[model samples]
Target: MMTFRDKTVVFNAPKVMGILNVTPDSFSDGGQFNKLDDALKQTEKMIASGATFIDIGGESTRPGATPVTLEEELDRVIPVIDAITERFDTIVSIDTSKSEVMLEAANHGASLINDVRALSQPGALETASRLAQEHNIPTCIMHMQGTPETMQDLPRYNSVVDEVIEFFRAQIERLTANGFEYKQIMLDPGFGFGKTLDHNYEILKRFDEFTQFDLPVLAGMSRKSMIGNLLNKGITERLAGDICVNTVASLAGASILRVHDVGEAADVSKIIEKLNQINV
Candidate 1:
């Protein structure tokens, strides 16, 4: 069970983390929920559909995307987070790499920190450690080869899975060194962050290798390029492919599936749990 604030999330099946991107340039669903009302409505729908967590992101971390200022990011996410917390009984995961945003979101009631950069940005580690201890929340540290802008340009890996595990090891050590318990950290292999089509699939095929750390594994393959470029399907049309990936990841021991569609992901979780129950 993962405890955050007053909420304790115990996942019998893979928990579906509904994606609520309040940005103008995310690869999928960008500019769709930038409004507070729309964001709340979406949050309501996802929670009603059985989302255990709501991942709210203010900045667009899409490859080649321009960066937003700290003020701009805060302006985009704080109000929506406040509204969601006021109205819903869901855990909000702040998807950011900025230390100030992390501190402010924690203050405003965010329950988890999900950073693509793994809290390596300037003061992020310090802030994250303090917040984890103060709020008693867990964090998701994702592995990326480089910055979003240049990550896809010339992505290479001696062994993608091994390198990612090593990255998680170093990150976990750093977080523990800064006073965070090992249980307070999770791992995300970052499907499309800096991987080619083959590299992404290789990681997915070897997803269980990460389970050796005994930490919850998060898979965020919803509508990523690995599916699109392989199947030639656009972002909105990748739901079928996304569901397939979610299923495989869950079967591979992913504890959390961060996805764009909560309803379908919930269905997948239920079915996978049922299938896993048979002791034949």
Candidate 2:
């Protein structure tokens, strides 16, 4: 199984994965951390805020997010990976499903492969499975209905919860048949990729259904279209909405909250976990 020095296993329990999108076109934090020096500073700050994992995304997977080739993706991410691995003693997750990117990241020092495509990119999943076995890296499998270019056109689901559960079951079977251990896997419901506002809310309301598999749930609703589109707000004006979404997600049993604002969300999680301990 994948392990960290601080006993922060990615798949076993709830953990905070702070987002560090080192790309120019990321939905929210693009161009913010693409600089090597800026990325290094942001990563260190995130670690100080109780983040267990640093999820670095070289490509923007936001709905209708433009695509980037493997070369561009690597050029954008490798330096950051090199810089972070050189400095931190924390687990760093590379958020990409491309096999080439995956292999390069494995070589560079990534411990988790958070794939939004769920590795459907022709041998991508299989490659990730093998890499996990080879490098002891855990993988987070997420469900997206369509390509990021067109996922928001007419996203539909008769019963999102059931369909997502089915997807997870099938994905798990695929990985298992490929010789992957269950302990090295995590699950993400992929809240805004191809869902309507209602579908997103439904997934959040029934988040516990995913916990049935006993896998850690990673939620990424921070500053997403689900919050601003629902509230008719802009990306720069969604802090309260983002915080509220994180609060609901944490309460709904999400093991990891992937957020853009690390320090604020870290404080919120601290207070909430404290109250939960009191109740326990």
Candidate 3:
């Protein structure tokens, strides 16, 4: 269980985190909700459908994605976050790697930090630590071999599972050394960040291994290349595949499933939890 200010999210069941990309260039839903009204409408829809958390991202971290200026990123996400918090009562997960952006988003009512880089950016660790201490929110640490601009260039690892475990262990140590607690942190293996199709599937197959750390694990494989490349489907047509991925992750003990299709993911969670409860 993680508490954010006055909000507490208990992972008694698999939680669905709806994705709200407010950028104009995200690989999947870019330009779909760059407008405030559109973004707000989407937020309402996701909340009504049963999303426990809404992840708002400004910059596009898609492969070979162009970098946005600090001011541009702030402009894109802050207002949307403000509107969502004002109109909704769900937890808001800010998907950003910049320290300033994270700090400002927290001020705007961001309840969680979902940094893809895992708070490894220069001032990210300090900023996340301060926010966690001040707001009592949890931070998600993801494992990526390199920057988004070059991560997919030729990602490699002698043993993906072992390497990821090593990375998480080191990162957890660092976070604890710098004033963060084990209970206040989560882990994400970064399915496609710097991995091949085989690597992604391998992580999915062995995701439960991460549970040994005693921290909640998050899996975000929504409409990613891992599914698209494997099924030869476009972004929009990958919903079926995405739901399959979410189901697999949930069965493997994932605490949170970050996804674009909230309703489908909610249904998946319901069915999975029901099956788990049955004596058969």
Please provide, for model 2 over 81-125, each residue's C-alpha lDDT reduced to its tens digit, 9 standing for 90 to 100: 999989998888999979999889978888888999998887787
What is the full ranking by TM-score, best candidate first? 1, 3, 2
Cand. 2 TM to true fold: 0.94
- In model 1, the runs with Cα more than 4 Å from the true position are none
| lDDT by residue for model 1 (1-280), tens | 6788778877667999999999988889999999998999999999999899999999999999778999999999999989999998889999999999999999899999999999988999999999888878778999998898899998998999999999999988889999898889989999999999999999999998998998889999999999999999998899999999999899999999999999999999999889878898
Off by over 4 Å in 2: 1-7, 10-13
> What TM-scores do the predictions have?
0.98, 0.94, 0.98
Residue 186 local lDDT, model 3:
92
Clashes of each: 0, 1, 0
CA shift at 103, candidate 2, in angstroms?
Answer: 1.1
Q: Determine the C-alpha RMSD for candidate 3 after optimal superposition of all C-alphas.
A: 1.0
**RMSD in angstroms between candidate 2 and the native structure over all alpha carbons:** 2.0
- State the lDDT of candidate 3 residue by residue for 1-280, as single tens digits: 8776688777766899999999998998999999999999999999888899999999999988877999999999999999999988999999999999999999999989999998878899999999888788779999998899999999999999999999999999999888887889999999989999999999999999998998889999999999999999998899999999999999999989999999999998898878778895
